[model samples]
Target: MSSPPIITSSSFSSSNPFSSLPEDVIRAHIFPRLDGCSLASVGCVTPELHSLSSDHQLWSHICHSKWPSTTTSTLTHLISSFKGGSRSFFSLSTLPPNHNIPSPSPSLSALPDQIISAVDIFYRGKCIFSKVQATETVSGWFKCSPFRIDLVGPKEAVPTPISRPSHEDTCQNLYADLELSWIVVDPTGHKAVNVSSLLPVSVERHWLSGEVHILYATVVCGHVTCSVEVTCVGGGPGGLVLHVTEACLKMEDIDGAHLNGRDSLVVLQRVLEGKRGNLCSENRKMGKVEEGRKKYLEFLERRKERREKILRREGRLDNLCVMIGSFLFVGLFYLLCFY
Candidate 1:
C-alpha cells in the first residue's frame, strides 16, 4: 500500500464499462427483467442468443418475473395460457340474456352467487364447445371444445390433473388426445375461464419476421374445423383454472341438442357424482381419502369453523367499539385522568 501511493480502485473506476458494451450484452442484462413469455420469445431471436438463454439461470430469472403479485398458481395459469396450453374450463360470464328476461325483484346482480351456483349446477360436467372459423366472406367459425370439470368448490381436489404420466416423446402430442380446461375461483367466486379442445398443432415460422404461429384442424362434432393461426401457450405445475367473467349464451344453437338447461345441470351433477365415485375407487387403490365421504365431511367442518371465526371476529370488533365508547363517556364526565 505504501509503495503504490494508496491507489484506490473504488474511488476512480467511474468509466461506463457496460455503456460501451455491445447491444447484445445490454440486452442480456435487460431481458432478465422480463417475464417468462417475453424471455422465451427473446430466445428465438437467433441461434447464438438461444444458446445463451438455454441456461437454467435465465429461465429461473424469467419465471420470477412472471407476475409481481399473483399467486404461484395464478401466475402458472397465466403463463400456461400464454404458452397455448389447455384452455381454462371455468369461465364466469354474466348471463346477460341476448333477449330480455324478466327482471327479478332483487335483480341478478344482487344474487350473483345464486346465479353462479345455478349455472355451475347446470353445466358443471357438460362441455360446451364453440366452433370459430375464419371465412373469406364472413367472420370465421370458432369450434368450442366440450369437457366437464369436476367441481370441489375452492379446495384443490385430492387427485390432481397432473397425475397422469406421459408416454409420448413429443410434449405437444402428449396432451393432444386429452382436452384441457381451467376454472379459477377467487374468494369472491369466479375469475377467468378457458376451454381448450385438443387437436394436432403445427407451428410455422414467419419467413420475414421470424415469429412463430400455430395452425391446427380437428373434427368438432363431425365438422372438419380448422384454424390457420392460433396462439401457442402452455400451462404450469398447478393446472390452470379459468372462469368466464362476462358471458351471454346465444340459445339459437340449441336446436338439435337434447340437453336443456336443467338436463345440463343434471348431467353435471351426475358427472360430479361419477367423478367422486372414480376418485373413491382410485383412493381405494391408493389408500387415500377412501370414498371421499370423510373428506367431504371434513371439508364441511372446516367451512363451518371458518364461518364461525368470521362471525366471532366481527362481533369482537363491535364489542370493542362499545367498550371504547363507555370509557370515553366515563372520562368525559368524571375527570378520570386527574384521578
Candidate 2:
C-alpha cells in the first residue's frame, strides 16, 4: 500500500502562527484575546508587533474590559490627554503607581464626570469576581465620616441608606448618583451572585493617605458566607486603585454548627498580619524618608485636631440633652401643682 507524502504549508507550519498571519488578521483574531499585561509583553517582542499593538481600537477594548463603567466620553477624554494615546492610558491604569513611572496627570477639565472603582475579589487566592463600579458617598450618619463605603451589586434598584439626589443635583455632580455594586461568584458551582444589597460593615480611613478600607460580608449560598475587605487608594489624576487585603470563606454544616470555620479564620488572620510590600519604592530611593516622617507628624496633628473637634461637639450635645430634660421636669412639676 502506498501513502501520500506528508505536506504542510511553510507559512502555516511556522512556530509563531501570529507572524504568518497578515497584520489585519492578527489584529482582528489574536489581539482581542490578549489582556493588557499580555499585550504589553507581546508588543515588546518586535517593532511590527509593537505597531500592531498600538492600535487605538486594541487598547480601547483593553481599557473598556478593565473599566466597563467608564463612559465613552470619559475614555475619549483620557485617550486625548495621554501622549501615547489609549495604549499609554491602559498601561497607566493597570500598573501600580511607582516612582519609576510618572503618574498620568490629566488636567481637571479631562476628569471623568463619575469616578470608576474597579474591583477584583479573590477567593482561596483565586480571582472569583471582578467589576467596575461608580462610587457614591454614603449618606445619613455616615455622610460626614472621613471614610466612605461604596456599594456595588447587580441590580439597578439596590437600596441605599442615602436618599437618591434630586435631578438638578445629580446633573450638576454626575458623581453624586453613581451606582456601586458587588458581584460575588461562587467557585464551587461557578455561578455568580450579586450581593449588592449587602452593606459594608465598616469603612476606615488609613492614617498614611486618603485611602479607605471597606469590609463586606454576605452569604453567597447555603451554609457558606464570604467576607471581602479591600482598601481603595491611589486616586488623583490617575484613577482609583483597590487592593484586596482580605478575602475569607466561612463554611458551616447542615446543623448550622461551624465546620472548619476556625481554620479559615486563622488563615485569614495570618494573611492580614503579613507584611505588605511598598508599591512606591521611589520615595526610599530618593531619600524622602525624612519628608515622609514630617508628613506622618502632620497626620498626627490632624488626628489631634479631629479628636478635639469631636469631643467639643459631644460636649455641646450632652449639655443640650441635659437642658431639655431639666425643662421637661420643671414643666411637669408646675402642671401637677397648679392642677
Report the error of model 2 at residue 178, Å: 19
Q: Candidate 1 deviates by what RMSD?
A: 25.2
Best by TM-score: 2
Instruction: Name the regions of candidate 2 deviating beyond 4 angstroms.
Output: 1-18, 98-339
- lDDT by residue (133-191, candidate 1, tens digit) is 11111111211322122223243222212222222223343223322222222212223
TM-score to true structure, per model:
0.21, 0.34
The candidate that wins on lDDT is: 2
Q: Model 1, stretches more than 4 Å misplaced?
A: 1-28, 60-147, 151-339
Candidate 2 lDDT over 1-339, as tens digits, reads: 343222223323457454467878778877777766667666666677778878888887776665453335633554556567666555433322111112333333332222333444433333334444443322333223322223442222212122222223222221222222343211111222223212344456565554445544433222223344544444223323333333322333223334342332222222222222221222342233233223334444555676788899999999999999999999999999999
